[model samples]
Target: MRYGLTFLALSAALAALAVLAGGAALVLLWPAMSFGLVGAAYLARRPALLGKRPDGTQAAWALVLLGPYFLLTWATWRAERALGRADCANEVVPGLWVGRRPLGDELPAGVRLVVDMTAEFPAAAAVRRHPGYLCVPTLDGTGPEVERLRELIERLRGVDGVYLHCASGRGRSATLAIALLLERGLAADVDEVEAQLRQRRPGIQLNAAQRELLRRARARPGA
Candidate 1:
């Protein structure tokens, strides 16, 4: 029964693809595809409900589909690990680290200040236990708030070691790291700051608005 359900689901998916290719509207095939998916999920959860067993050929087709399913799952797992490596934290400068939220309680010694740029506080109870955890909620955009962010960073920089992060450590955190580098005169320009960051954190990303904000902030008098 499970094998039969798998075949039906696969067939429905193929039919949906064919309909899409034929220039038919998706609404025409969505019901069939959805019904097949629901049926398969139901059978998977309660295999005994079907009572009857599948023949050998039906079982074989099911195994064939199952093989790709398992392979795809493994590929997804590996890809996630690779992507995690790309986003792992790295020291942007001496005593300064940036990346996605760090795991475990074993942060490096001297990391006394943790600046969280995420819109919401981190869910980890362990993270909240840090001695100096500061949350500065912001998004990736240009606004008067950039000046306040600079001020926040300035206060945090007085500590010996600072760790900066956001939800993904890609947009808002990277933007602030660049801003910090500019404020400190450690980087001559946005391009230079970005180059340094990318060298240390391979997947660091900054949106157009963040880049423009950095430029405008850097150009302001006494910035």
Candidate 2:
């Protein structure tokens, strides 16, 4: 019994370690590493679970632990699958999407939308006249445009998608858009989204930091 308990404890410890490592990796990779730690845990415990018939108490204990585990793992997978092609960081709020250039027509209903207005292709500036839309200064991830993005999100009802110019599709605007979506509720799969954007918009460009930020933003619950 003591040995069994020790083994269980060890598994839990290893799971914790995996979570840290996987979570760190996923912050920059998005869905790439979301389930890595959880998968590791299940693999670690599989041998023990198969070794004997779990009795009532042990079964109950297993239920307590595995129930939440399964739920989180399943949810993570669902999020990853659903958000595979979604652009933006991890913390984007509840709702948002990425649409084609000249975005207004393709936006989803009840979703707040924005687009780039700068001259730079693939990475540009926010439209100065547009009050509630998200835009950026350059593909390099600099400028004051980022500060006002939160205000824009706060003023909006629901975010559908942020549109981008075909040339400047993957710059600071994309990162900011992803951040706002995460602030609203989108998954941080910026990498996948960016990849798709590049394919769709051949000349689109994005710098490393903006790309990194897109994968790391965590969603703000109830925001």
Winning candidate number (lDDT): 1
In order of appearance, the predictions have TM-scores of 0.57, 0.32
Mind giving the per-residue lDDT tens digits that candidate 1 earns over 80-124?
646655644678899888876565453566788777654322324
How much does candidate 1 score in TM-score? 0.57
lDDT of 2 by residue, 1-223 (tens): 2333443555455556656778554332322232333243333423233111211012343344344443543465447546656433221223533332232343344444454423222221222233445443221233123334455445543534434322223454455554554554434465555555455434335566455434333333333
Prediction 2 TM-score vs. true: 0.32
| Alpha-carbon RMSD to native, per candidate | 15.6, 20.5
Off by over 4 Å in 2: 1-114, 117-146, 153-157, 192-205, 212-223
206 Cα displacement, candidate 1 (Å): 1.3
Residue 79 C-alpha lDDT in model 2: 70
